[model samples]
Target: MNRFALNHATTKFWDQREAVEACARIGAGIGLWREPVAAAGLAATAALVRDAGVAVTSLCRGGFFTGGDRAAIEDNRRAIEEAAVLGAPELVLVCGGLPDRDTGIDTARARVAEALAELAPYAGEAGVRLAIEPLHPMFASDRCVVSTLEQAVELAAPFPAETVGVVVDTYHVWWDPRVFDAIASAAGRISSFQVADWVTPLPAGVLTGRGQLGDGCVDFRRFKTAVDAAGYTGPIEVELFNDVLWSRPGPEVFAETVERFARHVA
Candidate 1:
């Protein structure tokens, strides 16, 4: 059986309390969002998940290098600290894109590398691995400068294995022509594998139209096969941010995610 998990963004309709309950009840792990963690109080959120015996797959987001400013870097560092406190194994980084008014992807990538160099040592000491999430090219303008697995791997070259890695999310990377080869190249360093489907007609430029599993273009079985072949033995987490799913009750969404995991991914 595939080990299914939930990214907290999918349950945006629920408060932290409900999110935890859903995960615990369904034997699912969680990928947490920074806002919910802050709102619930990091310590309290950590304790709640622990008390419910749920595993946290990854902490959703730490990087915003495009800001290329002191404040953004500090915020990223704090995210690492929060991940450590929660016992999260990986800190998923959606490295920011161009600074306000910029339009080049190349410059943004250079900034990401610089910021990664700064945080790697600190993240290593925190016992947390920085999982760089390569957002889809659609977000190249404002969300993440890193948009391909090859680029993501190259970006982690300067960091040690324990300090840095990459996350392979189907929603973000499914369209990459080199995805198969990249996964093979990633080998043991693919820190997290998040699953979600891609939808057309993006609501806005900021990446908000993620599709539910089996509801869109993603082929989870093939993707999971690739991850497994690459020796990634971690959980395949479901992470979606669709307005429709977000408007539904937490329990209903939880049930559908698990059903899809079994029907399609397994």
Candidate 2:
């Protein structure tokens, strides 16, 4: 099953073209980010992947809907269009967190649902599924209100399977007590499955501290087994957001990621 895919965030410092080529060389799929794709020019990036025969499993993001900005919704529509241009079937959405300290989480979560209701049809029409990525609870205050796989699944439930789904990123959900049950419940709703280990003593902002596979406490095989039991037969993307790995050469990191995936995830 060609299950190994590398998410661009893992190699944040690498040039977009070089990263895509590296994935192509290994016959692996890639998860692209919007900023780099825009920097390379959407058409150019699309052509680059097309010529290299690299599949774009999903786009990095397309949400931040709690800010009361009409522009956020417009931006997501554009993201859907970009995913279509890249022949990617999934557009990952990191639903934004509380708008302010005074704003309640319930309000923020409701806004996410409202935004999805508006965008789901557009995504379906463009032949892309909106994958809600539930960031960890640590990010609940400033990054994402969708803080658990269960929340992601529930938010996606009201939409059509082809229109909305959830991302099962181990780094974010591994600590959850009910994660296994959540994965099983996700079943056909899992649009993307990303892996990254969990490490201790987080970095300053806690943004780039994701551990490399086999480096920390995640039980990747358990996750793989559960997802498989739930009927997921798609790519398993390795998406580590770590500063240490970003300092090394892109190929070196990519090679190591493949080795680790074989040892811990595949």
User: Which candidate tops lDDT?
Assistant: 2
**Per-residue lDDT over 132-171 for candidate 2, one digit per residue giving the tens place of the 0 to 100 score:** 9999999998889999999999999999977899999999
The lDDT per prediction is: 0.86, 0.93
> What digit string (tens of lDDT, one per residue) describes model 1 on residues 29-81?
88898898998899999999999988888998888888778888899889999
For model 2 the local lDDT of residue 73 reads 97
> After superposition, which runs of candidate 2 have C-alpha atoms over 4 Å from their true positions?
none
TM-score of predicted structure 2:
0.98
> For model 2, what is the alpha-carbon lDDT of residue 146?
97
TM for candidate 1 is 0.96
**Segments of candidate 1 deviating more than 4 angstroms:** none
Clash counts for all predictions: 0, 0
* TM values, all candidates: 0.96, 0.98
